[model samples]
Target chain A: MNIYQYDKSKEWFQRAVKVIPCGVYGHFSPAPYAPVEAYPFFSDKAEGARFWDVDGNEFIDYMCAYGPMVLGYHHPEVEAAFQKQISISDANTVASPRMVELAEFLCEMIPVADWAFFARNGADVTNMAVMVARAATGRDKIIAIKGGYHGTSPWMQAPGHHGTIADDHDHLFRIPWNDLEALDRILAEHGSQIAAFMASPFHHPIFEDNALPADGYWQQVVDKMHENGSVVIVDDVRAGFRLHMGGSNEHYGFKPDMIAFSKAIANGHALSALVGTDDLKVDAAKVFHTGSFWYCAGSFAAALACLNILKAEDGPARMRMLGEKLTGGLRDLASSHGYTMIVSGEPALPYLRLADDETLMLQQAWCGECTRRGAFFTSHHNWFLSTAHTEDDIEKTLQIADEAFKAVKKQFGS
Target chain B: MIDQLKSRLNLKAVLRNLEVLPALDPVSAELISDWNISLRFSVWRDTQVVLDFHDGRCVFHSDSKESTSVNLFFSSPAHLNNMFENQASPLPLKGFTKLGFLKKEFSQLIGRLEYFLKPAAETVQDEAFKKVNLALSLNTAVFAIPELMKLDPVSRRIAPQFSAGSLQFSVDPDGPHAHIIFDGQSRAVAFPGPAVNPTAMTVFKNSEVAQALVAGTLDSFAAVATADIQLRGMIPLIDHSNVILDRLPLYLQ
Candidate 1:
């Protein structure tokens, strides 16, 4: 399964050093304890089941751009749609045929999305959700969970985190996530003062894969926030499109006041949507919600294609099955090697842990072992399985995992 | 007489002239009641000055500005002098006698003065911030004096344009308060928490002055000043360094 040699990657890395800082934009994704140099080989191109770097090295991609390429990289249909859009007009100026088609598709697909506002990135829609929540309730403070990645915006981080905001703009009020009792205490204490409770249904950096909320966690948060005169904002940016076409929220049988989504909607194209209830969507209109680059047509066409493919005979179901098989194989391999590994979250997105000390060192060791064999990147945070990945890819991954598991057992033997 | 007071001694104009308050040029006399305590000597700014019967109790019912000032009287002129000197303490205006026609008027001024004397803390800290304070109760780790402003050579190299500032910090079990006196100046900016957000942003931004400030490692105001910490804000006021340091620590939390 392995394609390229190690020495070639070193040369490419040397070339990268002359140009970029850290040699990447968002690739410092090693477990905190992992050695800096042993992260993973950089990517150049990817095809069905596998990808390569500038060094011409190949490895099975489980990082999956942290879940955006759910159909895997360069799916033929998705790419074809993008090529058509590019040939037509690049979809920037005149309203592209795909935008209206995509919007109508979303309204028909998701039960809650009556009106849709499109953007280029997850941060854009997430910010719009917060702004609309505030205008609907006419309150300034937002309540969000700890260790959630809503975005890097100052206002969004303000309410959930204290030190995350600037001193000049001190309106943020942070609250702990998941614990209903703590949320109730906060709601009772500051009922009239709060604007909304914005939360990601799944935990990100803390737990691997998907950390499903406790029983009735969503309902309780919504009920309590509403009682306190605050709206609810659901951050489905990563969790959306992975579990279902309507997103994972429908699985829980609860509807949020607003939902923000992006990754995986367009294979690799950049497009995001902020869909909410009728009342909240009205307020979204008043908020200044315009971004120039969001009008890119290539992304919209790709998204429409992705959504159409997602509902086909066996799309999300296939991806989910692949994810389960990969994680299940790793667990079996680890157990066979007498290693007690902790792999949390939904089988749809799995991350591994050798011990309680989930720091950088262990992450580095695990990732280095995988890279040596040919599993490209290890996010310790979340794992993504694309439709492009097949059963043969999973079998090869397990074989690599068996070798890595033995090495880990020997290295960290009790 | 009313025209003379409006032209010569309009309270709002007088406060603006002194620059003791921010400009209220667009606001009208009717809106003075909503002005924050920071705006001093403005028209109808305070309901009326109060004249206490015991030590702190007071009554002034007149709505007219004419009768408000006359009815109020201070316990002693010396007490009034002392009130201005110590800005931290409440002003004293205790004694009052029914001075003929003035009795009804001074009562109104007493009510307005009470409203004017509300603390600045009430205005700057909003309701949301109050909830945060309640949610987080801290037990701080204070740094020792020698560790307060220990400079690092690497920080200086990274921030070559660094200027040394004399920094002081105080550590309580709850949190650290830092004050930096740039170049031996007494005006220090006080930062309330561990140097976190501002320090991290500054380090990321490649500012040597911020690097020096981090190297100073200030925790609170009690620690001694040293030539380790550096500042790069609106400077030249060394004694007011506390204001700068005070705001820096909040970002860390």
Candidate 2:
């Protein structure tokens, strides 16, 4: 096996830092990449389930652009729909019919959606969801899971994060994930002041094992929120289409009053949505939320085509099958190398770590080696599987992972 | 909140660095070599830190003892802070015999420290001077986090969020390193050198990167993106620590 070098990637990054803040800010920043030398800093191009770094190293990408490239990079049906819509009309003075069509499709597809609202990113819709919840209940407080990430809004960011003040979290209360007793306690004290309880369908916090909701956790949470006259919001932005066609809530056998969807929604297009029950439709509209480019039609067409293809091809099941095979193979490979790989969360979106090292240094080194060997794996974040990943890709990834495990063993010990 | 944190930082983090001045600088070592005395700085009803000089070295302690040495008292945190800022003077309550030593050798030692901490443009061009400055700066930055976490409103709120573990910050290849250990109960203890089995780590690629980051001449986020700095392990701990680090310049400057 040949090792990869990133001279060109490094050069581009050197240039980028002069012009761009953090070179590639947000989730794409290389700050979290352990042994940063082993990872490429820039990409040249991407296709189905693979991308070529600026250094010309090809990788079997498992991150899927951190959950945006769902069906795959440059998915044929989605691109064609976007192109057709743009060639006729996209951003126009009068909104295109595609907007209505996409909303209708979403309302029909999602179990809880009676109406759909559009936005440009997950944060836009999530911020709107909070406003709508407060408007409906006339309350000032919200309860959320401790580590649940909604978006980068100041209110959503943890207290003491850069540019955030202590009062930013004044009305927000956090409870541990799946702790029903904590919920009961909070409701007992601040029930009337609580407007919403928002969280992801499953816990996928970084640098820790992902957790699924307890057997009756969501159902009980929903019932309790209703009794308190507050609404339930499922921030399904990251795990939306990958879990279930309707919503991740549907997969968990519970429903939320609103489901915020993004990431895989338009198969990499810049679009997000907040769909809510009819009871909150008036409140949602009255919140007075709008973005300049929210009426763009090309992404709506792309989303309609993408969702239709996902429904036809059973994209979630396909991703789950692929994820299972990949994780199982990786686990066996770890065992063979005298290591224990703890895999958690749903099969479709798996977070892997090495049980051999609690500090995660070993896992980080393994991930770095795998990334350098052409399987783009991040140690801390959950890996996303897409319908474009075939069995061959999985096999190749396992081979790379095997080599990575060997490299880690050679560096550390058995 | 700012004044209280600044005062604690002045005593615990800033003044505490005096313990290392002898090892890092020959002048300071010589000045303190013949001295056998403990100097205590007390803010009324608040905090007291003692610096003991003996055997060509200095050591810091949080607890006070009934030793025959020197004691400087301040009426409040603001009074202590004003002394650090050179706007006021401490009222010596004991050891009138050592006042000459304090005025001459001790004052010169403090001058040397101030020279390193607030270096002139030409002095910083010297490689050796730059190295000592970077080390002291790193020490001050790491030591101040615990004080801020205990005193600053925003940092106090963030302290409990840290998982109980040690976070190591290091400059690569034989440069300085420091550790901050969180007990998961809003208390943190900071010390010099690498931590064993740290829960998280932030490493600068070399002395150049470390100096740039510590001096605030380089953007940290840009450095991370360019791999001049690397972060690993439990990232939330590192992230929360960085947030506290962000406020360091406000007090340090």
TM-score, chain A, per candidate? 0.90, 0.99
Expressed as tens digits, the lDDT of each residue in A202-241 for candidate 1 is 6664323345788888888878777777888778887788
Q: List each candidate's DockQ score.
A: 0.01, 0.64
lDDT of 2 by residue, B1-253 (tens): 6787788988888888888877788888888889889999989888898988888788888746656489988999999999878899888999888788888888898888889888766764578787778778888988998998987777888888888999999888887888899998889999877999998998889999998777669888767766688887877788899888887777768
lDDT of 2 at A29: 83
CA lDDT, every model vs. true structure: 0.53, 0.90
Query: Chain B of model 1: TM-score?
Result: 0.19
Per-residue lDDT tens digits for candidate 1, residues B1-253, read 2222221111211111212111211122223333222211111223222222222222212223332332332233333323333322223232223342223333233222222322235545343332222112111101111111222212111122112443333222232233333332211122223442221100111222222234454321111111122222222122122222233242222
Look at candidate 2 and tell me the lDDT of residue A174. Answer: 97
Q: What is the TM-score of each candidate against the true structure?
A: 0.61, 0.96
Global Cα RMSD, each model: 18.4, 1.9
Q: What share of the true interface contacts does candidate 2 keep?
A: 0.71
